[model samples]
Target: MNIYAHFSSIIARHLAALVAAGELPAGLEGYGFTVEPPRDPSHGDLATNVAMVLAKPAGSNPRAIADKLAGLLRAEPDVTAVDVAGPGFINIRLRDDFIRARVPEILREGTDYGNSALGSGQKFNVEYVSANPTGPMHVGHCRGAVFGDALATLLVKAGYDVTREYYINDAGGQVDVLARSAFLRYREALGEDIGEIPQGFYPGDYLKDVGLALVAVFGRTIRAMDEAEWLPIVREFAIEAMMKMIRDDLLALGIKHDVFFSERSLHTDGRVQDALDALKAKGLIYTGVLEPPKGKTPEDWEPRPQTLFKATEFGDDVDRPVQKSDGSWTYFAGDMAYHYDKIQRGFSHMIDVFGADHGGYVKRMQAVVKALSGGEADLDVKIIQLVKLWKNGEPFKMSKRSGSFVTLRDVVDEVGKGVVRFIMLTRKNDAPLDFDFAKVTEQSRDNPVFYVQYAHARVMSVMRKAAEALPGVDLSDAALAGADLGRLIDGSEIALVKMLAYWPKLIESAAVAHEPHRVAFYLYDLASEFHGLWNKGNEDPSLRFLIDGDKDVTLARLALIRAVAVTVASGLAVLGVEPLDEMH
Candidate 1:
C-alpha cells in the first residue's frame, strides 16, 4: 500500500546486502536515505539519494556506489528499469503491472485504504475552540474549530487515540459580567422599564430567554437578595445556558468535542494550588518583582511584589506571574493547572489551537508542560489567523443574524458545513483565510470542494453507464479485483495509478507533521488530475472510460476510475467532508 516505504526498505535491505558482500564498508550501516517521486517526473517514477548518503560513510565514490546499486535494483521484479541521475541519485521506474496491481487493492479497501498504524495506540489530546462562555461563538472561532476537528480526524486515521476537548473560561471575571448581563435580561423579562443597556455590559438579546426562564423558575422573589448573594446563583445558570447555545452553534457546523473542561473546576477542587505546589517542588515557582514589558507596558505599570513562575529557566523571555498583587490566581495559573490535568489524565501528547493574537503566550505554555510532565509531555499550540469573509468579490458586510460580527452558524447557514470546513482548511492555520461565498459555491473547476465532489459524482455516472455498455459482466469490486488490469498500460492510466499510490504515504507524512491542511492540498491535486483525465476523453475516443465494442479495455479503464473516486472519498473523510454520490 505504501510504495514509498516499500522501496525505501528495499534500498535499505540492498545496502545491508552490499555490506555483507564487502562492497559497502561495514560501518556504513544506518545511513539515512529518502525515497520519493522525482520533482521532475521525467527523471523516473521513484528516486532516492541512497548513494549520496552512504558514499562518504562507505569511503566509496558516489557514482561507483550508484552504478553498482542501479544494477542490483534493476533486478527487482517490481522495478522495470533503473538509472543513475545527476550526481549519483538512483531513479527506478516501476513496471506498469506493478502499478496496476494496486488498483484492485484500492477498490476492495474503500476509504480505509490509507489508514496507518504509525502511532501504535499513543494518546493525543487536542484542545481548541475554547471560546469563552460569555456569549455565542463568533466567526473568529470558526478556523480553530474546523482546524482542530480535522486534525483530530487526521490523528485517528494515523492510528492515534485522539480526544477532542474544549476548555471553558467560566471561572474568570467575564462570567461574572455574564451573570450581570443575564440579570438585566431577568429584569426585562419582569416587564421593568429598563432603559438602554449601559456600557461595560453585554447588550446582546441572547440572554432574553435566560431571563424568561429565571422568571418562570423563581419569579421576582429571588431579585430582592443582595448582588453578592444573587451573583453565584445567576452565574451558575448563565454559564449552563451560554454553553448550551454555544454547543448548538457547534452542532450546526458538525463539531462536537469529547470533553468540555471548566477552569472553575480547578479552583473548586484545589487543583490550581496543587499544580503550583508541584512547580514549587521543582524550584520553578518563585516570588519576584517583574519589570515592565519593553514596548507594551500598561499605563499603570509598576514594579510590584508577586509570586512568579520560573518560566525563563525553561525558554521564556521573562518569568511569568502566577498570582496578582491582589493575591488572586492569574489566567496563566489556571492554564498551568489545565495542562497538569491533561498530563494527569495520561496524555503524553497535547495540542492547543489558539487565536493568532495569543502568539506571545506560546513559549510559557510549552514551558509549563515541560515542567509539569518532567519533559515527557509535549504541548504544541497552533495559532489560527483571522478569516475575512467575502461575497461577490467584495468584503462581506454585517451578518443579518447577530447584526454585528458573523457567527459560526451564520456562515454555516450561508454555505453548508462542507464548504465551510473545506474552505477553512484551504489555507494553513497561521495564514489568513478568505471565505468567499461566490467562489466556494461555484460549480466550476476553480472550486476545490465542488470539483472534488463532481469527480466522485462523475465516477458514479460512469459506473452506471459502464454496466449498460458492457452487459453480462460482473463489475463489483470482488469481480474487478480479478479483471485483466494488464490491459491498463496507457501512460495517462499508469500516471493515475502512481498518484493513487502516494495516498498512504501522504497520510503518514501529513499526520506526522501535524498539518491537516496538507490533506486538503492532496485532495485538490488528486481532483485536478482526475478532472483533467475526464476532459481528455472528449477529444480522444480511445481514452474514454467506456468503449462500444472493446469490453475488456473499457472494464480496465473503469476500474482505474473507481480507484480514483475511492481515493478522493478517503481523503475527504479525513477532512471531515462527505463525498457526494451525486450533485444537483
Candidate 2:
C-alpha cells in the first residue's frame, strides 16, 4: 500500500511499453525516476521526473516525451488526470476514491504500516554512548544515547540486523585514577580522616557508597595489602560499580546495548598483540619516528623514533604513533585492536558515535580501519555536539570537576524517560542543542513533544467519544475492513489521509540518511496537519468527526482519525516515546 510506489510502477510499465514500441530508446535507465508529492498540492497529487531524465538519452525533446507519457498515464484507471509542467515534469492527480480508500489499509496495518525492507538483511553495528567508565553519564551522553538507539530501531524496521554496542574505556589512565579515588573512599569507609581529595583524585561522594560496600565485603583484609596487589582489586571493583551506575542511567532513559565491549579485554586475551601482528603482516604496522605535532607542541616534547603505523599511506595527517618512547601501547593501539576484533566478528558495516571533542580523532581512526581491513570494512563516526543546558532562559550552572555535573539520572528524574528521549533527538546530532528544562515541560505548541503527544491523545479522545455516541458501530477490523471511505469527501479529510500515505516513504528516507531527527520533524508535521484539521471543524460543522444524521460519513471520518493515531503512535514508538492517550 505505498500509493506513490504503486503509481510509480504503473508509470514505469507504461514507459517500458513506449520503449518497446520504439517511441523511446531501448536500454534507457529509469531507476532514478521517482513519484513524490508535488511541492504545490494544486499542481497535482504526485509528480515524476522520468520524462525529463529520459529525454536526453532518448534523443527527443522533453516535452514530446512528457506528452507521450502523460497520455499513457491518463489511460490508467487509477490516474484521473496527467499534465506536463515545468520542462517535461509529469504531474499526476489520482482518482479521489483511490486516495480516500487507503485509510482502511492504514487502520488494518496499524503500527506496521510504514515498516520497510530497504536494508535487506545487511549487518550493521552501531556503537554509541561509549563514555569512559569513570563516572555516571551526563547530559552530553544523552543525545548520542537517544540518537543511536532510535537509529538502531529505524534500521531494524528497515530490515537491517543492527547490534547496539557500548565501548568501555576501563583500561586507561582514567580508570587507574578511578581506582585510586575508590581506594581513598575505601579508607574513608574504614574510618580514616581523609582530608579534601588530592589534586589528581576523584572527589565525588557517589563513591562513598562503593567504599561502604567494599568495607562490608572485605572488612580490613584489603587494608593490609601492598599497592601493587590492591590496585588491581580496587580497579575491578571501581569499574564494575561505575559500569553498573552507567547501565542504570541508560535504563532510566530507555536505552540498552546488545554488547558492552571492554578495552581491557583486548589486553587480557592477547587480542591486542594479535591485531597488531595481523596489521603488521599487511605492512600497515612499522617501527618509525612520528613527526612532532604541529602548532605548539609542548615545550617538553622531544622528537624520538618510536613504533608507528603507516597511517599516512591510508590518508592521515601523519603516521600515528602506536607505541610511545616508553615502550607502552598508546590509546590508538587498543582502538585498532577493537576495530579489528569487530571486523573479525564478521560485521561489515560499523558506526561509532563520539562526542564533538573527538572530531580530530575521526580521520585517524578511519585510516586505521581502512589500512587494517584493506578497505573491506567501512567505519562511520558520528560526533554529537555539546548540550547547552538552560532553565528559565538562563544557562544551568554545573561544573564537571566539582563532580556535581548533572547525570543522566538527574535528567530522567526531572522529566521522565519519554520527554528525555524525544527532546534529545529534536535536533541534529552534529549541531549544538539547547535543552531548556522549563520550556520542554511547558504544555504548548512550542514544546514539540507535548504537541505530538497531544495530537495522539486528541485522536484517542475522538475515538472514545464516537464509541460512546454510536454503540456497536464496529471499530473492529472485520466491520471496518470493508469501510465505505468514499463518504470522506471533505478537502481537509483528504489532506489528512494524504499525509498518512507519506509515512512509509518518510521512514525509509530517514533510515537511509541515518538521521533520526527527521522522524521527530515528520511527527511534528503530522501533528500540525491533525491539529489543523481539528481547528477546521470549528468553522465548518460538516467537517467535524461526529456528524449527526450521517452514520456512514461518521464511520469514514472515524476510520481516517484512527489511521492518523496509528501512524503517530508508530513513529513515537520508533523514537522510544510513549504515545499519550490523554494530555495532562
Candidate 3:
C-alpha cells in the first residue's frame, strides 16, 4: 500500500465533502494536491500543501483553511493529530499503532509486498541490445543489455505485458562482409593456405568455427561455386552462428529476449513496400534533395534528389533519406518498416535502448513512430553511454578486429554475472560508467552490490538465529503477521519501517519514469537503513532483534528484517541481480 497515495485520496475526498457542505469554496475541487512525507521527520509523518493551494482560489487565508482542514483530518482513522505548519502546509502525525500495523502487513505479503498495478496490463514493447549479427558481443554491449532487461522486468513488476526484443541488423553490408570473412575461414578449413585476412575483412577467429561447420556441411564442393552462388549461403550461416554467440553471451548475464526480429524480414513478403506505402499515402515520402550536412560536408558531396521521409514534419531535425541515389533502400528505411511493424502489432507503448553512438538517430526514429502511429502511440529511446573498464586505475580496451578487446564473457567470467549486472546499473544509462575489476568484488560498504547483497545475507543469518533463540514460537510469516508490532517503538526501528513503507511508492514512480536504475539506488538506500538498524543494536541491547525474555518485540523485529530481505530480493530480481544469502 502506498501511504502517500492513500492519504492523497483521503485529503481529496475530505475536501470534496467540505465543498458539498459549503464549509469550503466550491471551485477548488479539481486542484491537483500533494500529500507526501515531510522533509523534516520531526514535523510529522506526512505533509500536504492543500491549504496553500486552495487559499487564493477560495478567497481566504491559507492558515484559516488549514485550521478547518486540520480538525476534519484529525477525525480520520490512523491519523493521531493534524496541525497547520508554517505558511499553510498541513503536517499530520499518524498513530504509532498505525505505523506498527504495517510490519505484519509486509510480512504477510513477503516478496510481493511492492508489486504495483500502475501499467494495468498494457502491452509494452522494449527493444534493446540490437547489436549487429556480424560478430560476438563485446563488453561495449553490456550496459544496454542489462539496462533494457532490467527495465522490462520493472515493467512486469508494475503489471504490464512486457515483450523484450532484439533487432538484428542482418540485411546490411556488414553481414555481406561477414559472409566474405567466413569464406576466408571456409577455404582455410578445406586446407587452402589462406594467408593473413585482408584489411577490410573481419579478422576475428570466431568465424573459424563457422568455416569448419560449412566444410562439414558442404564439404570441398562449397569452394567450387562463384562468389554470387556462395555468398548467400555463407552469409546466412554466419548470421545464425553470430546470433547464437550473442544469445549465449546474453544468457551468461541472465538476459533473454522474447523476440529476435530480423531486419531482413522487413524486406521479404513486401513488408517494406507495405510500410513505405502507408507513409507515402500520407504524403510523408517524396523524392527530395537533402541540404548539405553542416560543418563536415564532404568535398564530394553534391545535390542529388533522393527518396526521403518527411521526418522534419514529425519533429526530426531534418528530412531523412529513405532511399539512396541508386534507389536502394537505406538503413533508416528498414528501421522505419520495423517500427511500423511494431505499431501494427498493437504495441501502444514502445521503448528502444540504444548505444550512445546511436544518439543522432533518436529524433528521426521517434518521428517514424509518431508518423506511422498517427500520434496514437508513444516511443521512448534510451541511449547508454560508454563503459570504461579499469584495472588498477589503468584503462582497458578491447577490439575484436584487433583481437584485443574484452568480450562480455570475459567480464562475466572474471567477476561473475551478478557483479557485472549490478555495476552496470549503478549509474544512469546516459552517464559514463567506470567499472573496476578489483572494486566490484571487494567486500566493503563502498561497493553497492556487495553492500546490498550483504544486507540480504545478514537477514538470512538473523532468521537462522531467530529459529534457535525462540524455538517454541512459530516465526512463519503467518504467525509474525499477527505479532504485537507496537512493541517496535524504538527510534531506529521506526525509521526502518518508514523506509520499508516507501517500497510500493518507489516502484510506482520508477516504473512511470521507465528507469530501473532507480530501483538499484532504492535497494541501496533500503539496505543502508537495514544496516544502520543492525549497527544500532550493538550500541543498545534493547534494540536487538532477539530479546531473551521479550518474544513479542523480537518477533516484530524479525518480521521487519524479513520484509527488508524480501523487498531487496524483489528489487534485485528486477535488475536481474541475484541477492546472496551468504556473502562467502
TM-score of each: 0.96, 0.94, 0.95
Ranking by TM-score: 1, 3, 2
Which ranges in model 3 have alpha carbons more than 4 Å from their true place? 22-33, 49-68, 83-89, 297-300, 397-404
- Candidate 1: tens digits of C-alpha lDDT, residues 1-584: 88999998888888888889988889765667889999999888899999999888888889999998998899999988899988999999998888998999999898998988988889999999999998778887988999999999999999999999999999999999989989998999999977988788877777888999999987997789899999999999999998999999999888999999999999999999999999999998888999888886577687889999999888899999999889999999999999999999999999999998999999999998999999999999999999998899899965544434678888888889998999899998999988888999999978989988998899999998888776788988768777789888778888888999999989888888889999999888888888888788888888898878887888788889889989999998888898898998
- Candidate 2 per-residue lDDT over residues 12-38, each given as its tens digit: 888889988988888775446878999
TM for candidate 2 is 0.94
Model 1: runs farther than 4 Å from truth? Answer: 25-32, 54-68, 296-300, 398-403
Off by over 4 Å in 2: 23-31, 51-68, 297-301, 313-315, 397-402
TM-score of model 3 (CA atoms): 0.95
lDDT winner between candidates 2 and 3: 3
- Would you list the C-alpha lDDT of every candidate in the order shown? 0.90, 0.87, 0.89
